[model samples]
Target: MTNLWSPITLGGITLPHRLAMAPMTRSRAKPDGTPGDLAPEYYAQRASLGLLISEGTQPSEDGQGYLATPGIYTDAHVAGWRKVADAVHAADGRLFIQLMHVGRRSHPDNTPHHRQPVAPSAIASGDSMFTMSGMQPVPQPRALETEEVQQTIADLAYAAKRAIDAGADGVEIHGANGYLVHQFLAPDSNHRTDEYGGTMKNRARFAIDVVRAVVDAIGPQKTAIRLSPGVATGGIAEGQDNDDLYRYLAVELGTLGLAYLHILYARNDPLLEDVRRSFGGPLVLNRPGRSRQQIGADVSAGLADIEALGVMALANPDLVQRLKTGAPLNDVRSALFYAGGGAEGYTDYPAIGIV
Candidate 1:
């Protein structure tokens, strides 16, 4: 009977427990896309969680979508991340940088290029972003030429290698959320008649290519992907054949022998069972708004090998200790969750017995 307290092996590292800190954007990176000076302390403080997947890191200038979000395509970015990896390692934790390409979820003011956002199609996500100036609507993105799409995949592979050079144990591809990969997954967002659209296989092409390229750059044992089936956000609609698409992805991408497949469990659809069987490897499940009492339910039932915590871990840096001893958790300051370059809600959360 495996439980959250049980140890599990994932990728190139073995966790002391099944609890992993899910990636949450802190918006504390330098404007130049380097991890901030306080990044090391922020991550090191939460190292007791064993496995910490970093916030979304763009792989290229065009991949960025948020203000002050980190990027991994430069030597400066590598150096900044090296501090993070070294700090987390010194604190006895393994770091996995999640490579995220926001695609059309971008505002020109938020990124360096100020180039129109690029995506599988020329469509605006209809989502608002809080840029440096103020909140603004995401503009219609430029449809990537087939060559540009290929370049995005190559950029992800290069970033993965850079993350490794920065001392990260592994890298996780951000295939979930209404970001780049999800843009390609959803029918409405990916209207191109190229090899990446129309049929389910074609629509899944970008996600698979990103994963395969990452695996090639690093190793199968060091590559992981996160997916959210039936998740509609940032103006994405999965439409019909949602389950069929995911099933195809599970079976197809499974052949690469990825380190793990993290599913953001937003629905109770039975497709998860098929996904579990198809992936046939380590599965990490993240359930939004899940209570503390329900933490290990999936793992105990064998539906997931690990559980990922977002705000719960964010509000409690000593999350592991508090859970083990049944200590009261810290309340999350929702307003400051995304406050860039501040230590108030970012690193000021008190641990157990600390004033």
Candidate 2:
């Protein structure tokens, strides 16, 4: 059986291991959307992972969702990210920026422009989000005009270029997590009657266009996408037809020859196999809520080419060494996952044989 330390090639980049550090929102950026000093240190500490997918970063001003979340479109954002990319590269670790456009999942207070959130339709998420003023109901968003949708795709392409200029290994479009792309994919959020709405093909058009634009900006080998099938987290409510939508979306995206497709699987649904067949490149699977004992089994069983980890990578900087040596794993504190600051569940975790 291949162990977790086995090497895997993700597109043109060759990873030293099959373990990828999944993107987790840290909410630690500067107020201006620039990644702070702590950001580089945090990512550099966990550079042992085969690949590090940075936290969800907004691709444009209106894309900002949570307060202090990072951005990649501005010059300041690029400079901030350059430091982070250099730090990770110095450690010989590969990094990819996850481009996230929150769509209706945004708050005016969280963004600098204080602009109303926009989506495929004017409907509200019926959910609340965390802001500087604490939890509040998500306000109704304005619907994007047909022409504005094209500009949004252009914004993503520009951001991908900026990320590459900032020294990232690649860019991963955040098409999941109930963000802008997911909102279009889910029938509940997308209520438009234009070319971007209605049937599965139309609904998937916006996401495909964004992907194509990003791929065109920085070749397909440097582009990737993250998708969640049938899991309705973060106020996203897609009906049973999610399987069909993903099957068609995946096949369409596969034609572009993207670097990889990262799927956050909810269950052992038969569609998982369909997605694997639909995507014609490297596949990275994140088995949410899986225990440590089940890690190696999933890969050995041919379920995924690479395994993505979240809290484990958060708590254990040397997770690869610990797992390979059969050492005890660090216990993660859920409370401090987004509390921000240093050494309090961020870098306090000890390395293998240290404790």
Candidate 3:
């Protein structure tokens, strides 16, 4: 049986272990949409993982959703990310930047231009988001013009190139978590009659195009994608036909010969099994909120080539070591998950023998 520490070959990269640190929004970037000074230190500390997918970073100005999130289009953003990449590399860890475009989930206070959020249709999430002032209701986003849709895909491709230039191992398209790509995939959000919307194939087109473009920008081996099949997060709902939707997406994307497909399991939906069957390359499965006891089961069962972890990676920097030696695990503080600063909950987790 394959253990969590077993080696796995994902795309062109050979990982030392099947344990991958999942992409998480830290909200620690500069207000100008660039990674901050401590960002390097933060990632460097957790570089022991087989792979590190960075936080949800906007591909363009319009893609900015949450306050203090990072961006990758600008030279300054590239420079900021370069530091992070160098730090991770110095620690012998592989890093990939997650390119996210938040369609309708934006707050005016969070962005510099105060631009109205845009989506496939003029839909409002009816949700609230955190701002500098406090929590505020998310505004109704403007409908995207058909012509502008291609530009957004182009922006993602451009960001992928910038990520490689910044020394990242690759880039992952953030197509999950009710973001722009997921919004397009969900019928409730996308009602357009254009080529970019309306059927499962059309709805999947935008994401596929972004992937192709990114792969073209950076080799297919370095480009990856993340998807959440059964999730209805952030007011985006996947209808009853989710199985058909993902099956179509997986088959089409599999032909691209890109990097691994990372799936966040929401339920025992047959779509996950379909995706595993349809996708031809490596598949990384993320069991949301997984406990330490269940860490090795998925890999051992051959259900996933790699296992992605969230809070466990955040709370335990030496998680690999702890799991190997049965060391005491750190208790994560939910309150400090997004709190800014050093060593509070960020890097204060002691190693196995230190505590």
Candidate 4:
């Protein structure tokens, strides 16, 4: 049985454990999208995890979805990320920066330019987003022109390069959770008739192009992608051919020889078995409702190479120790998660023995 404590290799880098720190948005970046000084300490505190994937960071101005989310396209952003990378590396940790483009899941007030959101089509997500003025409705986004689709892919590649230049071990393209790449994947959200849409292969083209571009910019060994086939977050209702869409995507992306594929899994998701068979590289499984005792169940069952934890890692800096020792986990104060407090619930989470 592959236990959570056992070592594993991903992208040629060996991890001491199978527990990976999943990315969670803390909204701690500055108004300018540069990560704050506290960000390094926050991540370094949980460096014991096999892999630490940073919060979703915008790859371009139009990619910004929420206020205070970080960006990876500028010098300031690179400098800020370098501190985080150095800190995590000092503790012998590996880090991957998650490149996220929120697509139409944005309000004008939330962006630095106050620009309208863009997506595969001009449809609104019928959702509201948190802005400086509180929550507001997400307006219908302008559809990206055929030529602009390539530009968006270029932006993602540039951001991946910037992350690597900033000292990150690699970058994970966020294709899940109704983001830009995902918006293009789901038929309901992407109603385009161009080369980038309509057919399942066309819908998967943008994501594959973006991945190939990122792999070119930063070697395939340092590239990865996260996919959520069954998720409908941000009001995205997938079409009837959702299974076929992902099956095509998984097999296509799996052929790229990338580092690993991280999946957000749910109970009895049939696509799990398909994706497992199609994708030949390392697979990291993230079960939404998994308890500590079941951390390594997927790995023990040979279904996953690593177990990725979100809330457990957020609330417990020493999550590995707590899971191993069967110690109580600190309760997560969800309110403080995105409250912008530098040290409140961010870095103040104590390990097992603190008083």
Whole-model lDDT for model 4 versus the true structure? 0.90
Cα RMSD of predicted structure 3 = 1.2
- Best candidate (score: lDDT): 1
Report, for all candidates in order, the number of backbone clashes: 0, 0, 0, 0
The TM-scores of all predictions, comma-separated, are 0.98, 0.97, 0.97, 0.98
Worst 10 residues of 1 by lDDT: 236-245
Q: What does candidate 4 score in Cα RMSD to the true structure?
A: 1.1
- Which whole-number lDDT from 0 to 100 does residue 83 have in model 1? 99
The digit string of per-residue lDDT tens for model 2 on 1-355 reads: 7666678887789998788999999887888899977888889989989699999999998899898899999999999999999999999899999999999999999998999999999988887989878999889999999999999999999999999999999999998888899999998889999999999899999999999999999999999999997878667766566679999998999999998999998784578888888887888898878788887776787778889999999999998888888888988898988887566767677887687
Regions of model 1 farther than 4 Å from truth: none
Model 2 spans > 4 angstroms off? 1-3
- Model 3 accuracy (lDDT, Cα): 0.88
Between candidates 1 and 3, name the one with more favorable lDDT: 1
Q: If the candidates were sorted by their lDDT against the true structure, best first, what order would they fall in?
A: 1, 4, 2, 3
Cα displacement (Å) at residue 96, model 1: 0.6
Colliding residue pairs in candidate 3: none
Ranked by TM-score, the better of candidates 1 and 2 is 1
For residues 81-181, could you state the per-residue lDDT of candidate 3 as single tens digits?
99999999999899999999999999988887898998878999888999989999999999889779989988999999999999999999999999899
The local lDDT score (0 to 100) that residue 103 gets in candidate 2 is 95
Tens digit of per-residue lDDT, candidate 4, span 277-301:
8988899888887887688889988
TM-score of 3: 0.97
